[model samples]
Target: EAGVTQSPTHLIKTRGQQVTLRCSPISGHTSVYWYQQALGLGLQFLLWYDEGEERNRGNFPPRFSGRQFPNYSSELNVNALELEDSALYLCASVPTGYSNQPQHFGDGTRLSIL
Candidate 1:
């Protein structure tokens, strides 16, 4: 089975702009999560989607949102982007109804703000 895949690998955006990051979870998985890893801050959970429904979100503002597709792929959208938003965005996945299973991570998408 294939692991999760992230697109672009790198993203450049200006302040106040919007950016969308994509992720495709492993086959047979139904849960997708988004996280941000910045220089100072440790890994912070951004969003969680299971079975095409948003399950939870972190302390981020409303501008941080995402959705899971029917095929189990996911998209993370950042609106009103800020310089602080520049970070490595990671996506992970585990099978549905199996929350205890370890989530496998994909290569993160590095976002840089100009």
Candidate 2:
């Protein structure tokens, strides 16, 4: 049973630069979701992909988007990043056809915009 993993546990970037974060879902999972958690803030859903297609997305701007690979891994892409974008980007994966199943999250990729 492979658990989720994120790259570059911490990320630092200047304002206006783009960043891409990676995530690998646990084995046997089929849904991957991306979230943004600012300092002292709650989780904000960015995108959701299940069965290799976009399933749902939050009210984020177009710049916030992502996709799930055939292997169930996923990536989040934020373009024209802003200082406000500085936050811990977390990814969660759920089981197939189990929307209510508790989502398993990775440690998250911390993105810092100067």
Candidate 3:
């Protein structure tokens, strides 16, 4: 089966700029998970968008938000980007009611802030 896919493999932006990262989950998946991996840091859960609603979110600031579409694709939006926001933004997906199952992840979109 095809794995999750993320768009714009790489992106560059300046501080205060806003960016949107897109993700398409594997076929049959209904939930999307977003994580941010900063330099020298482990993956940090950013948010979870499922079905068509914003389900749960991490301790990130309000500048971070996301949404799920009817097709199960998801988008992560970052406002007022900062240098520290530069990192690999990963997207994962899992089938509904299969929370116990491991989530499939994409290569991730690399965001760089200058």
- Looking at model 3, residue 32 earns an lDDT score of 93
Residue 55 miss distance in model 3 (angstroms): 1.3
Query: What residue runs in model 1 are displaced by over 4 Å at the alpha carbon?
Result: none
Ranking by lDDT: 3, 1, 2
Clashing pairs in 2: none
**Candidate 1 lDDT over residue span 42-109, tens digit each:** 99999989999998899999999888889999999999999999899999999883657898999999
Error of 3 at 113 (Å): 0.3
Worst 10 residues of 2 by lDDT: 92-101
| lDDT of every predicted structure (CA atoms) | 0.92, 0.90, 0.94
TM-score of every candidate relative to the true structure: 0.96, 0.95, 0.96
Selected candidate, larger lDDT, 1 vs 2 = 1
Q: Which consecutive 10 residues in model 1 have the weakest lDDT in total? A: 94-103
TM-score, candidate number 2: 0.95
Which stretch of 10 consecutive residues in model 3 shows the poorest summed lDDT? Answer: 94-103
For candidate 2, the per-residue lDDT at 57 reads 93
Per-candidate alpha-carbon RMSD to the true structure: 1.0, 1.0, 1.0
- TM-score between candidate 3 and the true structure: 0.96
